[model samples]
Target: MRKVCCIFIFCFSTYTTFAQNVASVNGKSISSKEFMWVYKKNHAGVTSASQQELADYLELYINFKLKVIDARANNLDADTAYKKEISGYESALKAQKKTSPKNIEYNFIMNEYREGVLMFNVSEKKIWSKVHDNEEKLLEFYNKNINQYNGNDFSDARGRVIGDYQQYLENEWIKTLRAKYTVKVNDDELKKLAKL
Candidate 1:
């Protein structure tokens, strides 16, 4: 009876640990904790998680992992883009480890390059063109969301009003740009990944 109880306990522990390791890509396990962190970071304000959402995200992440592995196998990791991404992530990790001003500066530069350059280029080319506004479109947007403009005098929220207007314009531009790109995710693959 004692041996049987011990086996049961061991089985339970193993199962619990295995469940916590969500997926293994190229022998690298992505822990449930890591997955949760990524999920929360991407969905800051969301209150609920749908199964489909989980599946889709998991699939996308696994595909990305596979791509990274492939890239390394093909020696693409030595390329500038791969190196930049790795360096940025490495710098961020190092900054967290040593909290030094120099490390902080390194992180800032890495973040700036990623957010300002790479992200800006991708977003501008894909999303900006869609939302690009001519006078007609701007006027149309203003007309549609007139309630936003009808509030108390602009003097009070002048900065906010202008920022909103600019963002609206940029959003339209991005919408236009995204129309040119072909982007699709496999639902079946996503669902399968969620089970992993």
Candidate 2:
């Protein structure tokens, strides 16, 4: 019957939509399978997440997306720093590609690496250079946190002191980034992920 065919077509289309899409951001589709894959990968050692925990992670994921979107909008994606980082990764991957021509895992790893490199490039431009360039500030930080170090000689502890100072700068920088960005999540779409 014509009605039966129409009903079947509708059901099939609905199923396809539900199966393929988890969420969309600024016209970008986030596939349910990919989202679930990442969720499982991140929570591999854990038993299971409560609904609240999953919801929290969904918000974090959205925030992460917003950050990436912001980074791209600001032209970080086109910057030499980001391009160089990804080029380095691609060169490394080229060596492995010879062994496995159809490696799905490498695609996911490359996605993670690309995003990581973008974030690192942004941080380097925004915070890392300032921290590294200020010798006076580094010395002041070393003097303030001198007790935390072990060796008596300042030269021996310079690396540790600089690392701690960089961490402090990074924390402060993250606060600024959080304030700068706005993140929104679609609750209806987020709930669908919980079912997976």
State how far residue 152 of model 1 sits from its true place (Å). 49
lDDT of 1 by residue, 132-176 (tens): 544455455555666887665545545555456667654564444
Off by over 4 Å in 1: 1-14, 45-47, 78-85, 88-196
Predicted structure 1: lDDT:
0.55
Best by TM-score: 2
lDDT of 2 by residue, 1-196 (tens): 9999999999999667655765555556566555656677898745355557766776566555655666686799998867887888778888866535267666666776777666666667755787776888888888888888864556788788778988787667556655666433445555665655
What TM-score does model 2 achieve against the real structure? 0.55
lDDT scores of the candidates, listed in order: 0.55, 0.68
Error of 1 at 94 (Å): 5.7
My TM-score estimates for the predictions, one after another, are 0.39, 0.55
Per lDDT, the best of the predicted structures is: 2
